[model samples]
Target: MLEKLPLGRPEIVVENGKQTTVAHSLKLKSAHIDDRLLPLLPTAMDAEQMRQRLAEHFREHLPNFEFKLSECHIRQVYYHPEKQCGVNYRLVFDNGNGTVFHEWLYGLMIPQGSATGRFERAAKRVKTSRVVQPFLQDFPPVSQLDDLQMILWLFPHDPKMKRMPDAVDPDFMKSQINEHAALLLDLPEAEARNWHCD
Candidate 1:
């Protein structure tokens, strides 16, 4: 079972002319993973299955909000000679009325070098950040839509992150948009091929 961690609030800070959003006062109590599941850890379930599990977990704990799973993938991070592989999940949850929304990223690590594969740890904490609103206006009126539709509507209109002063990384931004479009919107392969971000 996943434990609930209380994260106080969200704040925005400007540093070196860049805007960053951060959450404070969030702490997760210790969580243990079942040792029997180590070997088949991340790959045991497909992305959709993982997303469903995440949604259920959050719904159980956060009954006041609606949850949407935005992204899920197996990720490996290198630390010098050692590497750690885990499942990374990005989720967006909103107040039932859609007046407020928060994004949370979670990481679950898998144990390595063990004969019986097992999950090493549950997510230590979920750092929640507010979704960036477009400069011209607030998020569209998406309250009436279902969870998936609300996410798709808000995602495309999300303000692109600025890499530096008055500039954006077009390739990186396009890839992000394209990936979400393909995955969430289920765009046809040919249509996705022709999609362009500008």
Candidate 2:
């Protein structure tokens, strides 16, 4: 079944000095996965841990790359240790070809002693707000956590595809997430604090 379906989603294919979005062959960044591989994802938030997970999957994966905070204007901003379980972590990665990639990670766990009924009730109240607005019914693919966590990486689309309002663009979405975090979380001025990586 896995071999019958394409190994990965279609992405921009670079031709002879011209770039076009096409269904290229399998590459780690673009390769789709089945349930068996999801368990390899990093369970912790440490930079090393995350890179290690990626390395384990992609042979050519680069663990060394310069990255800035998701929110550059903010200083000393970090995720809340205890509340970092829910949908979070939006990051931008330079593809080294003048194209940028956007990656989003999400996981929402009901706290201990919190009944499912109460959690569902709270989810209903806040689902429409900026906090988890992107998550409602999105049903994004789970990351390596095997259960509640999932990740989605957005690649550059063709010009017409990009023109569509719902086109995938990581930087734009990252800003929206930052803005939502600032407002909903009541973060400090000039700083964006999160329950996980920006």
- What TM-score, over all chains together, does every model reach? 0.28, 0.25
Q: What lDDT score goes with residue 158 in model 2?
A: 16
* Each prediction's RMSD to truth: 18.9, 20.4
Q: What digit string (tens of lDDT, one per residue) describes model 1 on residues 36-144?
A: 4343332322455656765664455446434354444322111111122222233444444555344323233333443122211111111121234332123221111
Off by over 4 Å in 2: 1-43, 54-84, 109-140, 147-198
Q: Model 2, poorest ten-residue lDDT window?
A: 71-80
Model 2 error, position 176 (Å):
20
lDDT, residue 66, candidate 2: 35
